[model samples]
Target: MRKIIWLASYPKSGNTWMRVLLTNYLRNSATPVDINKLEGGPIASARLWFDEWVGVEAAELDDNVIERLRPGVYRCMAGETHDTLYMKVHDAWGRTDRGEALFPADVTAGVVYIVRNPLDMAMSCAHHWGVDIDTAAESMCDPTFATSRSLGGLSDQLRQSMLSWSGHVQSWLDESGLPVHVVRYEDLLAAPAATFGGVVRFCGLPFDAARVGKAVAFSDFSELQRQEREKGFRERSLRAPGSFFRRGQAGAWREELPPELVNRLIAAHGEMMKRFGYTTHQGGNDNVD
Candidate 1:
């Protein structure tokens, strides 16, 4: 019985890029993997999957009911698949109101927790959510922050609790009792071959340097951006004002973010930022001062 390999991260923290690398690495094609036909994993919160697993419409159930049933969905997924399940998760690792682990460890293979500097993430998050930087930064600080939380209408996914950016990092790293391989998004950009290779190895996949190198090249930002420019990234937020792959650089906060806003993020997430080497904006390409 194979288990799930969770690609866990706060939003805009290189989850999709990791998926792209995995997709291309596994395919080993001469051409780039189609962005829309991504098959590395299914997002853990797909509503239709919930509907299928429970044999009832997700919309008909209360959110708490849905939350309680989520673990069952994964258990069913684990039972049904003979292969390892790679799942993308934006939700913070947490227990439900009934004291149940939202993601059951019994069914989990392991976790790859991706961390990004909150300072830079704010700008990308703002752009992705179609909000100003301040609003985005504010949301990252709020412990109650979540996505697809509309009760007025149905979203394609169930509401995913993000906690705060700092909380999100802490939950997966310190709280969840899963074996975790931590990757900083900065390292992924600056040293993709090594970083992505680590991810592949952590998931118990055989690593070939040539195959990993090819994947890194195929999943390069320019290639993804080119693909988005041509067709589109289906995973892009509907509210995103521009392409999902727009400006894949790491240190944009230095020029784009105001000094005050930068200070605010550091103040809120300083401890975790320091732990993840996000303490500065004047160091290397990622500005890990």
Candidate 2:
């Protein structure tokens, strides 16, 4: 029953882009896939999905109780579907308080973990969360950082623990007991065909050069941005849940990001960044084309 493929990433990473790419490749339509009408499964943290799958009243349950039941809920979800389920996930990979894995391995086919340079991601994070730049940077440095709390009332999704940027990356890449394909946001820009083609092959999906190329072209940043401009993004866009598409450049952080914040992120995420060949030094950024 191993048919669930998780597309996991920290918030503001290229998770949405990956989803669009995969969907478009599969659809292979004359036009790009609609950003708002994506066909892949909803995010793992979607509260309604849990309530529906678990067949319980979530209003009575606390976050911990709901989280504890998530693994089984996912297993049940996988059992219901005969085809592969490409699900979006933002929660850090780990076990629940009761020691059950948040995402059990038996039902998981694989994971596509997308990562972006934290330096560039900081500004985007700021815009996405409607927070100041400093708060965004600090949150990434925070090991206990979590969001989507339904404290006052219910929101669209459940609270997801991010466990800081570096920890988030480490959780899925190193800790999660599943086969993972790592995709860097910068690589998607620099080598779309090779990068996305690799992802297709890893998922055991049929990879046609023309199809992959068309998907890549269809999901281009400018195209996404233009669509957002003409209409609007239902996902996070400038914290208004509006534009969603911003500067997709790799190393633009050097000119825009504050110097002090750069040092801070480097200090917090230097090791993980180094592991992915990201510069751990101050003032450093991705050397993208």
Candidate 3:
């Protein structure tokens, strides 16, 4: 049976980039896998997958009903696969309204949690969600923040509760059921080889430096941007007019975020920022470039 390994992250936090690298590495293709064709595995929230498993349309079910059934859906998925399946998830680690674990331990192998600086995340999220940086920053702090809860029609995916940025990070890191490997997006950018090699090792996959190098090169930001420009990326939000792979720079927040917004984010997330080596106004080794 294939054990499920979750590629968990906040939105706009390089989750897709990691998936691309893993897909390339796994396929060992002579040519880079098409950006849209890269298969890390199915998203946990895909409505069709849930509907197929439940024998009923997910769109017709109440959110609470769907939440209650999620653990079973994942358990069934885990049994169906013959190899380790790396699935992407944006839901915070928490329980359903009925008090069941959102992701049952019996079905999970481990998790690779990718986190980015909230300051940078705010800017990228603003572009991705077609909102102002200030709005994005506010959403990051909103404990009830979520996506894919459309009332007018069914969303392509299921509802994913973020539970605030800090809460989301803490929930996974603190959960004891699964071994979690944390990857800082900035660290991945600074040292792709070392960082991704660690990820491969964590996933119990043998590391080949040459293979890692090629995967990194193939999935480089420039290449992703090029592909999006040539053929539009499906994952690109309809709300955003530009490509999904907008500026992938690490510290673009410095240029994009207003001073007041930066301060607000710093104040809201100061403790977690300190824990992750992000320099707040009060100051601790400034890791941001």
lDDT of 1 by residue, 1-289 (tens): 6799999999999989988898898889998899888765579988878888899887877778889999989999998888888899999999988999999999998999988888878999999999999999999999999988636436888989999999999999999999999988889988999999998899889989999999999999999989899898888989999989878778888888888887777778887777877774433234472
Tens digit of lDDT per residue, candidate 3, span 1-289? 7788999999999999999999989988888889898675689988888988999887787788889998999988888888888999999988999888998888788999999988888988888889887888899999999988735435788888887898899999996467899999999999998999999999988889999999988989998988889998988888885789988878888778888887787877888887777874554236464
Model 3, residue 241: C-alpha shift (Å): 2.2
Top candidate (TM-score): 3
Clashing pairs in 3: none
Give the per-residue Cα lDDT of candidate 2 at 281: 49
Screening candidate 2 with a backbone cut-off below 3 angstroms (N, C-alpha, C), the clashing residue pairs are 237-244
Candidate 2 C-alpha lDDT tens digits along 36-123: 8786677898878988888876666778888898888889888888778899999999888888899999899999999998888998
- Once fitted onto the true fold, the runs of candidate 3 whose alpha carbons sit more than 4 angstroms away are 280-289
When superposed on Cα atoms, how far off is each prediction in RMSD? 2.2, 1.9, 1.6
